[model samples]
Target: MNHHHNPPIHHHTTTTQILKQSTTILINSNHLSTFFLLSFLIFSLRLNVETATHSLTSFIDHDPSIKSLLNRLHLPPSSSNHHSPRVKKPFLQLTRVGTLDDDDFFSGDENPDHRFFDTARNIKKNQTLLFFDCFDHLGFVNYSDNGVRVPELVPSNGKVEFKLSESVGIDEKIDADDIYSENVNEGVEDFLKRFELEHHEMSALLFLLGVLSASYGFAILGFVVTYAWVLGIVFVVVVNDLLKGYKSFVRTLWDGSNLGLKRLSGFIVMRWAIRDALTQLLGVWFFGEIEDQYLFFKIFVRLKLMPFSIVSPWVNGVEKEIYGFLLSWILLDTLVSFVFAVDAWIAMADTRKSVREVVKEGCHLLSLMLHPAINLKLLEGIVCGSFARWVLAGLFGKLFASAFQSFMEVYFMVTWLLYYFSVKSKDANASGVPFGQRELERLLEDVR
Candidate 1:
């Protein structure tokens, strides 16, 4: 047997190192003025949507007929002052149901800080509260629920007493919308008439649509400008400008006027548009199927207590299913992004390569991005960013979501660009040749 030693293929850079480097480079090259400009434009456009939505919501909330209709449909209450309650705060006192041992004592009962949270009126008396000790990673509460309470300033108390209304039975469940309901017997159409926009509201709606269109147009233009600026910074840093990367984006925007080939790296934008269109089509098809399946799954889960149900016992609600759908969507987006990242850079770097060739190489080299370590980290980052966007949108509405998305967009671009660079460097090193020489030889071979 021939004895031979094979060297281990070691990647010098870790995902963390790449992330840190990308962050530093992006911060150095980022233009806050452009970001703020885009944000302001988005904010201005979203203001229209917000106003329109708020106007519609307020109309529905304050209108007795509409409120009655909604109540008949068993929908949740609106977050408007039309149904705001003016109840006095309830008296709270702690009570210990069991005696404490000699070794067990309240450490600091005197002048102890106490806190109380008001729960919804629908809360039943015997409902279970699942508690976890996160600090120790304990799965569930360590103590029993029977004898847990305190008094005015007790520190080591575990139970509380609420001065609830005697009218509410222990097992009685309340509907939050009951107070907002009216005695009207109007039909849906009769109530919908209340939503007919006034002259001013109509004007606002029209203006909103106009502003929304303008915002989208500006967004497309902004995309081109951002690509130009990023390419400029990249070229300036890399000392390569063959694609006229140093050209002023303003002149290109002003002269070419439209999204034409005359603009700097306009073809890449065209590629992106096509890719995005296809991706969106894929999403529509995928999500349509997913929605149908999700509906079926949701119904199946809800019917778990019925005869011959197939769903697992733990699959009680649609929450976990929705998470699964979201995760699948993110994976799809990440994979699509992997291909587009390479394709975009190829289009920017070399116009000589046809679109077909660029796409072919992009798809071919996607395996590089799929390297276990790198892809997992990339997926984690995407998940974090997406989760943050969802949460911010829910809690604070459109403004914060728009701003966060804008920042993440550029940050991810820089990250993928750095990743491409790292992959190229690794390829060059593995081949034991300079990058330019390897490219030249490949081109010559292709020509042959």
Candidate 2:
């Protein structure tokens, strides 16, 4: 123990070391505090800017006048005048009318109106007869009363009229007598005499008959050539081939059954079955695969070929399955197509939900970062206290940022949900079914 009071060198050295350590600790602490404060401030400022911009954008979007102004600036109309309103007319009118049964008006007797009409008709006939009688008694050979002989109405001379009237009256009496007798010979002689003189004057009628004869001859020739010869041979060939094929199919399906052999019943059944199966399966797969694009065409073909089958319970089930798969395929195709079609900004705008998810994850990270530790109890208290103070001061700012972000996310989610529900409701309505949240939940309940 060189107790020689050696100046306390070790103590001085230890004191200097302690001072350096304290200075370093103070500097580091100050740096860390400054960094955290700066970070918090910057975060707050950014949040405020973002929130203000979003609020401004929402205000502009919601303002009809602002939107109209933007529209005018971006897209002026080609014409300046406003269009006039269209005029329409009412066409139909509902009116009340009395109703009466036919039996009530008619008591099984001739209608009085019908008797009146017949009487008027008889009066008109009598007037015509009287006029003709006066013309005959005049014996003036009147045609148009002005002595102009109308070609089609050439009147007979007086002598000719007298002779014709006498002959006609005598013939009428003779005709009446002949009608009561078995031998009606009185008019036959006169008719023969008339025909003998008129037969040579009948050239016009003969010419018409000749023309008709010629036309019928040509028609007969055409009919023989077309139907009896050309079509007959074609019909024979087709019938023969059909009968041969039918026999073959029948023999294949039923070798020895007498009924199957008769009328080619086996062939008919086999052919129909094969055609049905092939058409049903292939048609369902091909048309149902491209349903959205080809539904109308498929429907037309199916209705034309298999209307009854399509309405059958079995086919209805098949159709539903086909349509369900088609709907799923179309949805997938649409999603894929949209992936290629959408612009970057639009896609990003639609990802507000994703941003919210990211923010939630960030909150978890922050919680982890702010977790308290037992080892550095005093330091933890100081940090937490300081953090709490800053947070309280900036609470509104933090909340504003969070609320803005959350609003965007909520708005996007709600919009998407609305769109999805609207489309689903429309489809269900079109299909004559009800769609609601309950239905949707039921559908998705078993999806996962």
RMSD of every prediction: 24.4, 40.9
Q: Best TM-score goes to which candidate?
A: 1
Report the alpha-carbon TM-score of model 1 versus the true structure: 0.40
lDDT of 2 at 179: 26
Q: Would you list the clashing residue pairs of candidate 1?
A: 94-150, 148-158, 148-159, 149-159
Clashes of 2: 0
Report the C-alpha lDDT of model 2 over 1-448, residue by residue, as the tens digit: 3224221111111223323432332244322332233234333433443343344334444645433332221111213234732221111111121111232211112222101101011122112111111122122243432121313332322111111222233223222132223222322332223223233323432443354345334433332222122111222222222222222322321321231123223222333344334434434443433323122222323322331111111123247655553344334433332222112112222223343353343333223312221112223223323233346448666454433433222222222222223333444455666544334333222212
What's the lDDT of the predicted structure labeled candidate 2? Answer: 0.29
Task: Give candidate 1 regions above 4 Å deviation.
Answer: 1-12, 27-329, 363-373, 376-385, 394-397, 436-448
Most lDDT-accurate candidate: 1
